[model samples]
Target: MNDETIPQITDSHCHLDFPDFEGKLPDFVARAAEAGVTRMVTICTKLRNEPNVRAIAEAHAPIFYAAGTHPMSVAEEPMVTVDQLVALSAHPKFVGIGETGLDYHYTSDSAQVQKQSLRRHIEAAQRTGLPLIIHARAADDDMARILAEEHRNVPYACVMHCFSSSADLARAALDLDFYLSMSGIAAFPKSQELRDIFAAAPVERILVETDAPYLAPPPHRGKRNEPAFTAHTARVGADLFGLDYVDFAAQTQQNFDRLFAKAAQYKAAA
Candidate 1:
């Protein structure tokens, strides 16, 4: 196929800085380009890792980045202040505020600390005018409550990264004009119910991701994921939205543009 005929998509969330692909980011990004995944946002889950994560984004034109203390590490890392996150956002490639939110499944013991961390991240996003990247796990109720509560305090844009939560949480996130990011898990055959939720959502409110070095889509399931696999999940998204590959790809890029405007604008100016 002619390269120009291929549609473009973005991997809204990934972790290219991790050791899984050490010394091989250029090759992985090349693979993503071949797959029509022309862009990605590599998340920095710890402040201490921000420099390295930012380097990854700086090293490749197709990449952008976000940073915040992940929920699981809330207790282990020093608590982040809103001012610190706000300061980081001043960087040109720093596109969002967090991979933060409540994750009760494995780290329920630190729920209170997680909430405090989440609130602080939310404040940073609010003050910086950047979207918040949320990671919701088994704490849907609290997650929903806190997100809604935080919005009431001060509104900010966000995307429920790798969203596979219940319909209630989906509804809550959507009601706030936030977005739902589709990941490899949504393409799993047994995830009919979750797919239904995406089908029920507005196309403009949906974004596609690989959550790379994590959830690889079908045909690559049970394998280590990378931004390149985002194309596979996006093909599934096309099916759910009842659109062709090109149209679906266009719509998602537009949705991503709307949610992560900093990334879109940065790319445009480049």
Candidate 2:
């Protein structure tokens, strides 16, 4: 289909600063636009990389960014402070607080530091009024408990970015009025269980992403992913929700606008 007929969507999470896209961002952004992925949030997984990631957003109108010390890197990176994260939010394109949360899959040893970092990111989200982007893995119980506990202290918005977690965790996040971002992983053949979890969610709370350089949906699976492939995952999201591609795309755009209000406002003002 042509641009007018294409169903526009946003890649709510990605990593454009990764070496996989180095020196090729313009082409990737162009390809994404061509594929109806009109906007994308490129994430900074380490505090030190925030400048590079922020520069990418500053250089590309269609790109926005979020920064946090990822759970896996919590052991290696300096623990992020709420003040540091809150300070970063001053940038017009700095949109979210994290890609934080628990990840016992590989970094189980650093659980305490991860938890500490997660809370700081949550507090940053609370302070900045930006959604906390989460990356939950095998630590669902702790993840859910902390989120629920802290949310009770002072509610904060969040999205389980590239979510491929348990139904219980999904429910916990949804219970707190948080969003669940569908990445290319949900489009995998063996991801029926994940799809089912998403299928059970309120459509108004669903968003879509690519998680580029990883989790490329079918037809591009096992290859480096990019924001352009968001349309592929979103097509599957449309099918799972029993809605036409355009309608589902529009719904997700509405959901994104509601959650990432800063980006939405930027677009509106532009």
Candidate 3:
């Protein structure tokens, strides 16, 4: 397809602040624009790194950001307060609350701390009205339970980033009106089951991401991933939902506008 004919899409979560892109940010963002990726939400998983990550977004017109203490870093970093996170949201380009949620896959030892951090982020999301960017791994049960418990107290919007979890957890998120962001993992040829999970989801509740500097999709699977690869995963999403590239791209773009209202308004006002 020609560049002019290609529909735009958003990479809802990524990590461009990591060393993997050191001196190549402008080139990386240019490549993403060429791929029809008009916007990206680069996540700040640790509060201490928020300034650096926020700088990257501020420097690049195409990039927006979110920040909070990541679950794996919960034990290492000082606890983040809801006031601190709400203050971060005051920045024009700060769009979401976290890459925070449960991640027992590697950090089960700090489950207690992780849970506390997750609630703190959830509270911040509720207080700020920004959609929570979640990262759930092997702790599905706790993830579901805590999210539900928190929602009962005060509702907040969220998206399960890089969703490769089980059907039950997917249902848990969907039941709570949360979105599911498709990543390179779902585009792997061996992931038919994961494709099926997304296929069953409402088209309007879907978003796409790269989580880059990681999860590079096929043909580039073993290599470093970047925002430009978001289109590659979106292609797989089109196939999963039995739609053509343009239509699927439009659908997901509308989905992103609804969930990331701050970014939508930022673009409109800019």
Candidate 4:
């Protein structure tokens, strides 16, 4: 396919506000745009640094943001209340509600705290009418149950970001009209099951992400990840679906727009 045909993607999750990329984010974002990454959602891991996350989004027209504490980081600082999340998310640059959910992978003792935090974030999502960017690790059952119960009455937009869970969880999320975004982990040799899940996922519900400065896909695994490197994830997804890189990129880009609905408006006004 020609350069014009290759989709201009959105890095659905990244951390431009992280300390490691502070002074160097401009160049990193620029390089990503040059490589056809037209938009990115800089995820927030802490509620206190929301200003910093918003600053990055404000600096770049193609960048958007999500506001909420990560499950792992929620124990750190000023606890984010549902009201606070709703108010903070009123900013135009703020497009979604979370990197929030259950993660028992590392700290199993904090399950209750994470669950409460997840509920607060879900309430914030319901109040704000915004999409949610969820992070689920070893707590797939809890994740699915919360989503199912919470969504039954008040259906809200949500994406299971950086998914590395069971097929049952994947189907449950999709059944909730929640989008499933794949991260660089899908590119690993040990992740064939993940690739199969990606292939079986409805195209409209599929999105591609980097979860950058974290999961850097093959050839760059264990190194610092960035938005530009998300192309490797796109390549991995394309290879899974038996499509060319550009085609798969286009498909996932469309899914990203639909999942993060405000992104379309952001792009339109740009």
The digit string of per-residue lDDT tens for model 3 on 227-265 reads: 999999999999888999999999999999999999999
Residue-wise C-alpha lDDT for candidate 4, range 1-270, written one tens digit per residue:
445654688899998887779799879988887778878999888888888889889988888999888888866756779998989877887889988998898867788888888888999899888898899999988989999999986889899998889999999999988898889999988999988988898877878889988989988999999998888888888888888887888888878777676778767876
lDDT of each: 0.95, 0.95, 0.95, 0.86
- Candidate 2, TM-score vs. the true structure? 0.99
For candidate 4, which ten residues in a row score worst on lDDT? 1-10
What is the TM-score of candidate 1?
0.99
Off by over 4 Å in 4: 1-6
Native-referenced Cα lDDT, model 3? 0.95
lDDT of 1 by residue, 159-243 (tens): 9999999999999999999999999999999999999999999999999998889989989999999999999999999999899
lDDT string for model 2 (139-225, tens) is: 999999999999999998999999999999999999999999999989999999999999999999999999998999999999999
* Candidate 2 Cα misplacement greater than 4 A, ranges: none
Question: What TM-score number comes out for model 4?
Answer: 0.95
Question: Which one wins by TM-score: 2 or 4?
Answer: 2
What TM-score do all the candidates reach, one by one? 0.99, 0.99, 0.98, 0.95
